[model samples]
Target: MADTEFVIEPGRQDLVMIRMFDAPPDVVFRAITDPELIPRWWGPHVLTTRVDRMEVRPGGRWRYVNVDAHGREWAFSGVYHAVVPPERYVRTWEFEGAPEEVALETVTLTEVDGRTRYVAQSVHPSVEARDAIVRADGPRGGRESMDRLAVLLGTVADM
Candidate 1:
């Protein structure tokens, strides 16, 4: 498997566009959907996460708690908008720390040859919300999460 890599771009939607990973689409999908596999790869590489509840179907809700270095525990909850096996999924997300800032996410996976290209889109309600997240270096945390995912996959994707 190749390591997960991503590029973040600022846009009208306050989008975080990324081209990541060189793993099988199923593997990447598993990283997103499997409760047992999630916390191991979920969150900024520096933060630790624990899945409180995860149900991966439309209307199913998922909850998680992330603890930062300062021992601050942040709680996040969301409902799954859609889930279709190992190909794609969409969900609505919000953190307790920022209730006004909701994030709608769409994740797509594709496999070429022996590798999978993973893309995730996060749409915020406002440009200000988007800018706030990016300026906070959101993807750095995501990068760490992906690195954890790579580790859980048993190996990093090809860097």
Candidate 2:
């Protein structure tokens, strides 16, 4: 890919954005940072993800332990940079699998037509890094997670 490919925005922030859900703002926010809820939707549809920790407050830490289809385990972790209740959050992320990688993530929640409009913005050290992540987890894994989150919200809706 070209450098312009991952030039998501003209600033140091808002490098990547993806939206794919129909839940409420609060519910979507919780699904992104809550430890108990992450495990249910934070992986490729074919893999099982396990959450070791997810502390949603500033300076807190979160860890993801994922198991591939063949029962392989990989870990990822990060510390929260900023945590704005029901609206915004920023964090530093690192994946402990393959050649290690790190990125900064910022998420904002908005209300669209009375439903949640969740946007996830991820920034990497460089465009090269961004392309690498896309190659690794692309083909809409994030979209799949968002889909899973919608399902989770549906499950909660009826309860």
Candidate 3:
């Protein structure tokens, strides 16, 4: 149970998130791509997440919604561009609330000494759109999600 730390770097038109997990690359990859496991760690603790549709393959479409305690839902949808099992994945992300804003995201996982380093790079349409995501607490939520993912991986390991 080491401290789960994530580095978030924001650029003019992109954001990069780096995190280390005490697990293998395959485990980390499954936690992210598996619809069953996604709800366990995809969002902050205060919200409940559900993956309505998940097809992890090229040209596949996916959608998930997060519901707050008050039952308000925040939905997100995306299209998969590439899926490299246990290593890399590329997709487009869009929040239903902000239909015009979209980001192309690439997630790469590397393993070293039984630990995996997870990196997610997101390129937005513009700097303003990128900054807006950060200002909206995207980093905070991402960090929380990683923390939860770490815990979930630990629990899964024991099972």
Among all candidates shown, the one with the greatest lDDT:
3
lDDT of 3 by residue, 1-159 (tens): 255444445557888888888889988898899999999999888899999999999999999999998999999999999999899999999989998998999999999789998889989898889889888999888889988998998889742
lDDT of 1 by residue, 63-115 (tens): 99998889989898999999987889999888778998999988887877856
- For candidate 2, the 10 contiguous residues with the lowest summed lDDT are 1-10
Clashes of 1: 7
lDDT against the true structure, each candidate: 0.77, 0.73, 0.89
Show where candidate 3 strays beyond 4 Å.
Answer: 1-11
Regions of model 1 farther than 4 Å from truth: 1-11, 155-159
lDDT for residue 30 in candidate 3, whole number 0-100: 86
**Model 1 Cα shift for residue 50 (angstroms):** 0.9
**How close is every model to the real structure, measured as TM-score?**
0.86, 0.83, 0.93
Model 2's alpha-carbon lDDT is 0.73
> Candidate 1's error at 98, in angstroms?
1.3
RMSD of 3: 1.9
Winner by TM-score:
3
